[model samples]
Target: MSEQTAPRTAAGDSTDRPVDRTGGGTGRGSGGTGRGSGGGDVGGPGTVGPEPSTARGEQTRQLILETALRLFRERGYAQTTMRAIAREAGVAVGNAYYYFESKEHLIQGFYRRTHADHVVAAAPALAAETDFAARLRAVLHAGIDVLTPSHAFAATFFKTAAEPTSPLSPFSAQSSEARTEAIRLFEEVLAGSTAKVDPQLRPDLPELLWLGYLGVILYWVHDRSPDQSKTRLLIDGAVPLVDRLVGLSRLRVLRPVTTQVLELIRSLRH
Candidate 1:
């Protein structure tokens, strides 16, 4: 399948042209500033304003985000700056900061957008497949497809994210929004599958699968294989084992083990 590209500006260009401020600056209620008067609150000091509510504002926001991601890919995350992103995006530095407070926020936006893309890409497979393992495989492959474009960037970004206390860590509180949404996607995967899971394991299975996916992503980051083919093989090999284990969870013999696992997970959370 062809790689899915990031959303582009409405004009379908990446030129460094200034944002059009012809009508009240980007959108209605924007007060000639990038921030709309009644936009969604970002809830932090020094933030320009709430998120843009108008279509034009949203387009501008997307343009900034796409530009940031591109620069991050080319310049490496540490070398890229908000000024550079704003200059490349053709928006004012304040405007760029208006959309994303910092580089960390931009990465969070990357996390959110990539997950959203994964969901859209996985929808077809989720709708067409009922078998547990097949559905799982489809979702996993879809994730790789969505991420394929960013593989080069991801390789370097992994170093910062790998730090246990870094906000970039997928398990960090700062990344909770993206993490929660990703786990929710796994829940959908399990919900639509035909597999009969243990009643007690149902609630926790999605999180377990999401954690497994993080492992897959880690492997993919280090995968030097052409086109990350080895990661694909890993997924293909791992899914059946996961499926079998999930299926066995319904057996009475595994109930105690499943409960112990759940208890351990809960303990770690606190």
Candidate 2:
């Protein structure tokens, strides 16, 4: 599947919000870069000692992460530098470095936590439902729920990623294998589904659905509705309907259109 074909819920990363992909320097949330200043170690080397200091270290790290998150949102990703983050965080540049290697490294925290949250939110609905259609709907809704909170950041990030040269682009060489692994995990979710797609297409379907999912996310990113109202509508209506359509792909009449769409997507990827 292409990026646009990925099986994504209405809630997604940067793709979910609306922002300018082109480098206008003024987008949604944040998209800036800078360097760190004030050198000091806030969370020094971890010693296998008492729990109190560990808790303190944890709190400090959280503070930095939270502070950085805010700054990144307020400023652009490119403008938010390590130095700026450290200054705002009330810590030394070395202290921020102790926790994260660079601003990009800090961004990874957003992706990592987002995926973890996706599973947590989806689990409950998935567990309660037995029908494949219902389960799929729950999974999609869960993803959307996790994503809504970061809509602003999500839009900016996706916009940045659309650029082929951006380091943060999903397909960029700079994207760590670990991040790709996250996409792989989402693929696993699709594997667990009971959607009656072609057996031959199963392996590729997850990737394709992921791409499709991303396409909707691209739309969601630019959505400006109150509470991203349009995204909610997509979740409530389009998703389940697509799920049903996929379930019905085995029908002879629809097969031609499906094949054409899939082929079109494949062409774009190449």
Best by TM-score: 1
| C-alpha RMSD in Å of predicted model 2 compared with the true structure | 12.1
**How accurate locally is residue 230 in candidate 1, as Cα lDDT from 0 to 100?**
100
> Tens-digit lDDT track for model 1 on 1-270?
111222333222232222333434332344755453444333222224435676766887898899988987898877776667877877655566667756777789999999999999999999999999999999999999999999989976678788788778998899999999999999999999899999999999999999999999999998999999999999999999999999999999889999999999989989
Model 2 Cα lDDT, one tens digit per residue, 1-270: 011212322213222111223332211122432112212234221101112146665665677778878876787665566667767877655455555555555666666677788778877766665555566557666767788877877766676677777656666666665456656755656656656775545556666655655666677789898877787677667767767776777788877877887787679768
Report how far off residue 87 is in candidate 1 (Å).
1.2
Q: How many clashes in candidate 1?
A: 0
Clashes of each: 0, 43
What is every candidate's alpha-carbon RMSD to the true fold?
9.6, 12.1
Of candidate 1, the 10-residue stretch with the lowest lDDT total is 1-10
Where in model 2 is the C-alpha error above 4 Å? 1-40, 43-60, 176-185, 252-270
